[model samples]
Target: MLKTLGFAIICLLLFGRCAQQVSPTGGKKDSIPPNLIQSIPLNKTLNFKENRVELFFDEYVVVDNITQKLVITPEADNPYSYRLNGTSIVLNFKKQFQDSTTYTLNFGDAIKDFAERNPAKNLKLVFSTGSSLDSGRVYGMVKDVQTNKPLFDALVGLYNPTDTLNPAKQKPFYFSRTDSSGVFSIENVQTRNYTMIAIDDKNRNMLFNAKDERIGFLSKPISAGVDSVSYNILMALSDNTPLKVQRTLPKVNNYTVVFSKPIEKVKVTFMNKDSLPYMIENGEQIKFFNVQPHSDTTLVKLSVTDSLETSTEFDQKIAFQAPRGKERQKDQFTISSRPENNRPLANSFSYRLIFNKPVQTIEDSKIELITDSLTHETLKNFKSTWNETHNELTIEGKSFAKDTIKWEIPKGSVISVEGDTLARTLIKHPVLNEEDFGILRGKVIGADTSKLYKHFIIELMDDQYKVIDRQYSSPYNFIHIPQGKYFLRLILDLNDNKRWDTGQVNKGIQPEPIIYLPEKTLIKSNFELNDINITLPKAP
Candidate 1:
């Protein structure tokens, strides 16, 4: 009797310890995914007619992002309602199934363990209403035309155009997104003549709305036979109508006018057809300078006249106006000075004044130049020359050892183009030291000796990969560098437009290719790094 009671007590203690719950403390993280134990009607069931499915898991599971993860082919009118039953998932379909068809549901990363959120691998279920399943498939790749870079998760679809229908107007019969390598495939498509299209679908709607969507399509509908068809798509945007004025922006000294597409030339005039002073910032951006101040709002008309023909460019003429206060609207022309505190006059340099508008006059009497030498005497002889636009003044002078030049422009000494008085300012700049700067010279090697190597651009990038200097690539490349890590990149200029251009879809233009060097160049202080070679690869 004593032995029996002891054994019963020991069993009770052991069972109690085994049944107790444990808090997640220090241990190896749960890396194992959930396991599917069984499913209703079995997986890949032929002639399946059930409206509901129950999936049993080995451990407790949760269904999250059901809409995004669960992709159903031949989609029903409504969505599936999911229910959690401990270690099981109950999916009830609200829509009826189609007749004589194979329906597939891919639970993509949705079935995850409740505790660790580790998902089951490739959870898919398929059923056929008929005797067999459709084996027709479509596979292809998607890439950016200009960069030749893969576009992952881009949508590729097929539409059956039984009627005269536009591919962008309706949803596709079958669709799939590209994988990490920009590859896409759709199965069970039902062999037929289909209009194929690929799009960067931003709205998640299967249809293509051209306003913001990039599209790639075939010239004619493709016939999908029993065999899988391979189609490669190059994603690009359709070019907008040319010569249309997009918008106008008013800055402190200039009005920036933008166009819908690149134009060779543009003409700006007042309502009275007077020629306006303008600068071409780019093929699209035009800057009109020295706009006269008006007491009230003024109307400025812009016209774009291309070589082919002149259409009514902008939908409406851009308007211009000046400020209504005694103060001028333009921001003050400020002078920034940098002086080399150590090793002064190490290199010959220029003292400059960058003005926003053309300077009407400069009072040389009020200008004083003093050097931070022992004597600290003011200099009288100096020459100033303005740039072509008259907006910049470069002071030509001689350099001295251990001397820091101080330039002082007194108040009301300089006049703006608007006849407004300028304020007093002083500036000082440091000369470059050979010891502080490094010289980098290298031979561009490993270039493909093909005819396609002509118009490539060699770009010197900083540590952050920002362009520090750009030059036409040469056999021997040279540039002065400050002590920092740098890299080189080569861009193939196909259009000879002086820059990399993105391709147009409707125009069938491909984007320029770029070759980025993997090796990094480190420029150290007081060191001239020479014989550094850079090799460029073939264009993609």
Candidate 2:
């Protein structure tokens, strides 16, 4: 009995200790990357003639994704093969080194410690089969043209001026990838004239794929021998692919056609113009509604023009079907106000009511406007108008007094298409005083006179870069703006398209330039700011 009791007590004590969950405290993590302690045929070796090279690290290291991370400048026909042995990496050359030429082997983030996987940064080996290494270097940054944001990991390349092959067809002669700051440096250059280009390589392939990649170029070839030879590249989606129809989806109530890319303009027509359907364009899809249901297929012609100004016309056969079962149920009629509920309205702005479908009839007697939630007035004096689609109604008072107003819309007051009636609604709008606004006026000094004749879309943006008000002409004059901190932006309408055109790659045109006022403009209540001048960068 004594032995059994002792065994039970010992088992309970062991189980309790295990259940207490004691965590082993290791002192500190090994955050340091493996250091290169030694190298065979040491770095920057002159007249390097060895067929093999070895790199020894302080700790056991692993080579990761060497095929993608490794690069050899002045590309060779037969590159080296890499192998790992214990705490070292070996490179065996497959061919003899070129005579009197400099070479660079870059192992970008490929060598890391075996335990923690901490990568070794800036692992590059430079040598020459000649007496000295090349002293030329090219440094630059890559940024997005539209947003002016740094593009990380973009590939910058150099090519011989006489090279006939484009970036899409051939890899660059010398290339380097941009770091986190969008900066890239290609050292050991030959100090010759070369054409330079940068691309946001999505596929990790050195070759630029025009179908998806964004590319940028300098207007002239650069001489690498010049002091401080730096160039900034502006990258844009230089897609010049011709627009093609991908597929056509015809449904019971609507017909949709999908294209390979988003189109700028689209037109859908039939043999009988009288039977034209209402068309709506949403990016890459063109939707058609109200096409009379027919038992036989109808030939529909579609013409679309993409952003590149490439136009294509095609014919498709579609059969329209009738709605069945639950599909026949009428869509719920809805109306929403612009200022929403209990929101303040600006004086220059008009109160609007948007409906789901086109409105047919409006009963003026059922609509009432209450001033200060007290005095009731008829809307006969208020000017009301409908938008082109006849689905939005705008109500504007000839002149609004600084006061709160309530709008009461009774059910069935407004009738829309398909015999839909508006629901009851109560909304409030307040007309603010003139003292609550401010004015901003500025002159753009370097806007091209020719392009200004076309127009400059001047915008007044809030602190968050959201446009508050816009004007077409320059010497921006923005009035009746709420008091806030703001800035100015100018969209150069080079093509007079009334929009910023991100250039056409096939035409070799750069995007229309955009300029922003450097300093933030603060608008004080009832204050007018002036004398803010801006200069546009010279056209490329």
Candidate 3:
């Protein structure tokens, strides 16, 4: 008390009259919250009759977003309104005070200064209209159940089963939002057995009607007594609603259908062997293409099944018609390079040319290397390979010369299916030296490629948990790591999709297993750390 009072005195001395003017820093930031100078009706007053109240502070104070941070309980039909008067808050109650009951005004982090804006801490002022004030108090924390991480600003409420009801429709008897650490408390609560609820109110309507709103609750009623009752609530996203077709868009030879949630097992049927666009199971979108429109219109159906195969949800067959009017311009087939243009390349590196459309021809005789507008060295012998889709072109050579070499593709050297010639282009490739990289070689033990789980991923991450590289092969070896400290995480690829799958609560399945190796490794120039085996963590 003395230290805060002294700080107030210093603040007053630094800037006069509530410090409305700017004050120079005293080489230290004022972390002390706004100190209460005085209050009307005083705190803990028994048989208090005054309805109007005023709280004076040592500095200019402002309260913003009071509806979210302020709570008055047991609640009144009409809320109190307040105004900032210089360094004071003058509050006028709208309803008459109840007799023999304790009323609490919890000012949670809403009151701050005009300058530094340092908030006043959890300030609760309690008073009684009758003989004595209620002594009961309740405190607890709220968090996400799956991630086990703290959630701040979550609404925590206590309700009497007899008098109060759904928090979705009305306010509870007492409520408060979680602090920065996910902790909340309501002091001077009435002594009673009450049902508790916590909600991540997304819309700030003080309700839980939205589909994305999270809900948590105490398993049973909490009985408040003279001492505080502490409890915790784990929030979870409700999955009671079944997946339904949210919308569908039909185009030429394709149907873009989206569901409310991710569906693992889905069956799509149509006359044409339509191809759904590649989307992870976690995404809600899927597209069907590679179709031949025999008629002007078509109908397609999509059915989704749950993991247990107990029930199947189906979407109404959507009808699509051929588009009318002018045709859209076709996208020109373009070429892109790898060990990319103007990039440093090693002598033994393989070059690649990726085309948006399949290339009809690559005139090998017209491709050559150049330097300073003069003809340069050419590949003595090279191996070329193309994918089945003809969209990729890979060229492997024996070795590249040391000079900063230039590659040239003469006009008409390459042609697309439309018979359009590729414009001549040039690229510069510089040889990469030895100091640019380090090697990472490690081993992953206890991997089983059985029916249940076929593959595991060993990922190298920086200190921030961002994955730098991931290897799915045995022995878990990675080369050419930049100089830095790295951590390792092993993921049990349950579905052999080569990615960790998130849990689906409705389907009753947990996420794919992931084990983070406990140790961090540092790699330097020309360093090789071998025999490091990272074992999977045992599930609890």
Candidate 4:
């Protein structure tokens, strides 16, 4: 009985060991992807004629998003259906491939191990139905024009010059994705005249959407052959969406028009023979005041143009709503001054007070300038001039002594158009001597000489990347900058709008070029950093 019981126990142990499953533990985890063991028709097979192919891996593998990751150069009209059979994947074509053509199948990170899910690296297969495969190859690196860094995973493609399909709308004839280093090498390409382009493909659809993607292109087509051709591409916004009125919000006294994108120029006029006072803000919004409750809704025509000179007219209806139930709180009236901190106010540097709204009045007698808390004088000779918008008031005239000074405004001294009164305020600053600051002088090279008068802007920024001072043209001299680390940025104001503008793809207009001084500029007090040269690229 004991022997029989021991035998039964042994049998139970054996059965349990056979039925239970457990993963191996305690060693280095598998970080490597499955390696391809073999292919049914074999890779690089020439004069191939097959409807189905099988890929074998040493370990069990999973096929992931093959439809999106598998790119067939000379893109296939019908996609291949793939299935995993244990350790192998079988691909069945929906239709036959082109006759006597070299085909490249780039299975980009689609095959991976089932256990760890590490993707198979560089899984590309080349085959040809002709006597020989196309040996053409194109290699290049893609970089961002703004950041000047490698653009990884950017799609680099080649297209036949005569193809009517747009790069933004269709896939390329042949393409390769950039690696981490922003280097791409498209192999097995047909030797022909092709237009090469690169794009940051945010969507996996393989089409360039100018509204969402950045693109780079060669100025002209290249005649590619068996020899490898090399070119560096730079990607930028290349935006081309037309200016559109996204929405119109009406208030009791005013209506605001918000645009879909930024515009350099805009003109709003009533289509039905009416005029309204309007002011544009930030190139994206236009606020029109209804001085007289002229109409509940009015037909207005908006004529707008971008920096690229692409213009569009939009006619829309503007409607106003009567004030009801607890009117919305108005924006808080805020005041701010520049040259803050301990930074000294230098010669010709005006002390300015900026407000959130248009200022209606300022009692000069209630404002006083105090020097070193000893001498006090009212704002008499100082020319307090409001800007065109009446939101910025510049006070200049009396040369402030180097000693610490303060500007004081008593309660109710200033008032805005909305009847908001200024509270008691004090702004103190110091006027330092010339020895406390340094000078930055630089010149821009390669800019169009004729366009330099007002079309180019050079800015000197502090270490924190804030614009401290700017000059309209170069050779530019930024005077009175405190001793610190600085940098330079140049803006090619192509439209002479005093700001940098992005590109428009439909108009074939690249962005207004911007170049940065690669290295930081160290400014020492009582010294001048001179002859900083900035070289601009040829206008696209």
Candidate 5:
């Protein structure tokens, strides 16, 4: 009986082990297929007379979308002549090869296996039907023109300027991709004068659509021959037609007119004609205004008035209903601190004033600063600057070593730029501190004195890659940033404007170039800043 019991126990243990081995709880092993072993005629071969080329791999590999991935440089008359039969990629030429010219076939991120879909990065083949292959190459870096930091994987291409073919309809004769350092290389280029363009393929279509895409280009033709060429490509927004307003919103008691571009001039007028209540505009950006109350419901129409006295009318209508509850009203002027803790000694601290309505201007005499201890009376001479873009007032003065400081803005003391009087009561605060403060500083250099970037942007980023601070300056301007570990970035202001612009698709305009600082270096905290020198590259 004891022997039988021992045997039963052994059988149960064996059954449990077998069940665990085959159960879903057991982890599965990852499988790696095979790599491409070799190809006939080799890669980058020159002076080839054969009409057909073959590629061979070690394992049973599958080819992915060969049509989109394979690009023939010095572009072939018929680019769609290649096919994959089983494990081999075959290229067939419909016409005779060009004499004494080199060609490159770049398979950009498209070569993958059948089973695992493993991609072969930058798989390219070069050959010539002539005596020698074109050995010229162009090397350069790409970055966000504004941030001055490297932009990886940006598409860089070369085109014949005289072709006159739309960039969207045709493929580039030569192309390459930017690396992690924002560096790109286009090799085996022929001897010719060509135009070079860098594009951020946001749509992955390998073309520059002005309205929806961003592009950068050399203003002049580039000569490439026997030696390698080096150039930096700055991406910029294309200047297509201005943005159009899509839809109007007056139903939620809020109306918005979206534009295809930033509005240069805006004039809003409410009109009642032919029983239609409409708001007309002579601008690209959407404008919002309070609507007049009419009974329980308000009806309104929207129209865009152009400079040429033409109006583009919309078919949609807007309606606003009365609120159900009692409305709450507060003071028109609201005062806030950047570092809300009232820590006076901190560097990032600042006093911000937001008006309920747009004020015509602010008067310098009505603003006042006081100290908590009452012993320091020299705080009255504070400098104030207003930012029209965000509609905020900035007041800067003597630094405080303590945790809090007193502030006073008396009524009728501040006047607007339009000479309008501020009638709100005085705003007084007891304590403000240093944790509410920040500083930024940098230096700008130019390719030459005459070619300085006029309106540039300097951005400071936190560790998580968020833009925590931003400042705009003219050429050779310095900025003070708050105390923090920041990644410094810069954008070249191409049009002498301080704002960043987007691209236009239908007009074939590319977006402006944005450059970023190298990731190897970053701005640190708590020290007298040094000049971050940036040298702008001349347009080719």
Candidate 6:
């Protein structure tokens, strides 16, 4: 009996220990690995011929995804030519000599073992095919020209200047990723003329598609030879192609243009009596097409033709210049209502106002609500809150009885941290009707509830699911919004950085994770004006 009791106690204790060890609540500790020691031919070597290259590390390291991670410059004819056996990486050239040619192979996040995934970090092997590697190299940092901050993971490439060599037809002779510092370096380049282009590779394909991507180029060709070159590359937006009319909605005074890129200079015009184009006012990027029927129908031709002069001409081709990627500013302010679709006949629904830029202060006097076709009155008992993630201002008040409301943001009412004032009459006449506007509201729960995210964003979408409204909030806070279907998402404002960041290939840092609310939240017309709420998941 005594022996059995002792054995039973031991088993119970062991089981308890095992349960504790395997429990998900018992946090597992992450391991750290050794750093890279050295590499042969040195990084950024210029001019010379050699059949083999080697890299030496301090510890018994292993190569991670060398195949996917290695990027050879001046890309060789035979690309699959490198071998990573253990601590060393070997490269065998398949083709014979090209005189005085410079080559660079960037081992991006590929020099780590299977154990910890610790990266060797920016390990590069550079050599020359001729007696001398080109001594000239260009060094500089890439950034959003407007923001003046380093743009991480921005692919910076060097191209030989030739009108025939477009980004789509050719690959860069040499390339490097912008480091966290937004700095990039291309070395061992021969004495010749080249152009620097930086692209935000939204598609992940190295090629730059002007229609879908953002590109920055030096207006002039750069000459490189004996000296190491340095240049600061400011990426600007480009309008490479004309706007494409996606769909036309003659019913509403609005149509959709699927731009090849985001354009700032958009102008729409109607043909005058002399067949000359007259500008349609208030055109902006993305949502540029407005149909509010300027003047009478008799003044303009209903079936206008393009320069092509096709017989059935309801379409007009407008030349537009897209703003540089760096200069594209996100439109922050959004207006939404609850019960997104099929709003009730009653005017009791609430209205939600969202902003994309951070608001330092909001003057209530500048906000006025007009109801019932012209009863302009100050919203009574209005309350406002600032959301840092969406950079929004949430204003709430008693419900109204009408389905349509004219929301006005007066000049000098909204201010930023820098005290930069919004345009006088920024939103002079924003009309929210039952057919288009909707509200989205949600709560943000952090991975560690005790740890609070600085801010959260809620975005509302139109019928085509484009973001039309947005709201920012604090964790666990509830916001009442308009009646419309919306795709709800949240961003943890970790560094207080206003922008989302992509992962770095060299540093092995994955892009910051954005948490999206599961399923599209729908606000129906019958929903209690104050009863709609949404909850956001935590970032993994």
Predicted structure with the largest TM-score when compared to the true one = 4
Candidate 6, 242-342: lDDT as tens digits? 33444432212222344223333332334642222222212321222222223323122233222112122234433333345664343333333343323
Each model's TM-score, in the order given? 0.62, 0.79, 0.57, 0.81, 0.60, 0.45
lDDT of 1 by residue, 1-540 (tens): 999999999999999988969796998998999888899868767787778988898999888888777877766565678999989998898865787887778787888998899999878777787778777788889986534567987888887755455546677777788899999988876777777778888876776665567777765677766676678887765443455557889755566777766665555556653434554555567666555534233356556754223444443333454546786566565443323223244334555667655666777766776555433323346676766545567766665635365566788887866566667776654555567767777655655464656677777778776776777766644445678888767777765667665454344344455666666788888888877666655545
**Model 1: colliding residue pairs:** 146-511, 338-429, 338-430, 339-430, 340-430
Ranking by TM-score: 4, 2, 1, 5, 3, 6
lDDT (Cα) of model 2: 0.76
lDDT of 4 by residue, 428-507 (tens): 77777788789888787765454443477898877776778787876788888788898788877877877666564444
Candidate 5 backbone overlaps, count = 83
Query: What's the CA error at residue 179 for candidate 3, in Å?
Result: 6.2
Cα lDDT, model 3, residue 352: 87
lDDT of 5 by residue, 1-540 (tens): 999999999999999788744435545542554455677677756677777777776555566677776777777776446777777777787766677878787776566666557666557778887877787888888866545567888888888876465566655788888899999988888777777878777776788766555567666678876675678766655544433566555533334566554345443333433121222233454434333443333233445444322345544333444445585222243444553424333333455665433455455554555454453433245666665433456666564435345555556665432233455543334343323434445565653463455567766677555776566653333234445566666666567566555543333444555566665344334344556666555665
Query: How close is each model in CA RMSD to the real structure?
Result: 8.5, 5.0, 11.2, 4.8, 8.5, 20.0
Worst 10 residues of 6 by lDDT: 304-313
TM-score of 6: 0.45
- In model 4, state the lDDT of residue 99: 89
Estimate, for each residue in 319-417, the C-alpha lDDT of model 2 and write its tens digit.
655566674455576778887876767645567888766567888767888777666666655788986546678888643445987788889888865
Residue 218, candidate 2: Cα error in Å is: 1.7
RMSD of 1: 8.5
lDDT of 1 at 477: 49
What candidate 6 gets wrong by more than 4 Å, as runs, is 1-65, 81-84, 90-93, 245-540
Candidate 1: stretches off by over 4 Å:
1-33, 40-54, 73-86, 90-104, 109-112, 116-122, 126-267, 271-299, 303-312, 315-331, 334-415, 421-430, 435-453, 483-485, 521-540
| Tens-digit lDDT string for candidate 3 (271-304) | 4544232221234655544233333433445567
- Model 4 ranges off by over 4 Å: 1-24, 162-165, 270-277, 281-283, 290-293, 307-309, 326-331, 335-438, 445-455, 459-469, 479-501, 512-527, 535-540
Q: What is the C-alpha lDDT of each candidate?
A: 0.68, 0.76, 0.69, 0.78, 0.58, 0.54
Ten-residue region with minimum lDDT total, candidate 1: 338-347
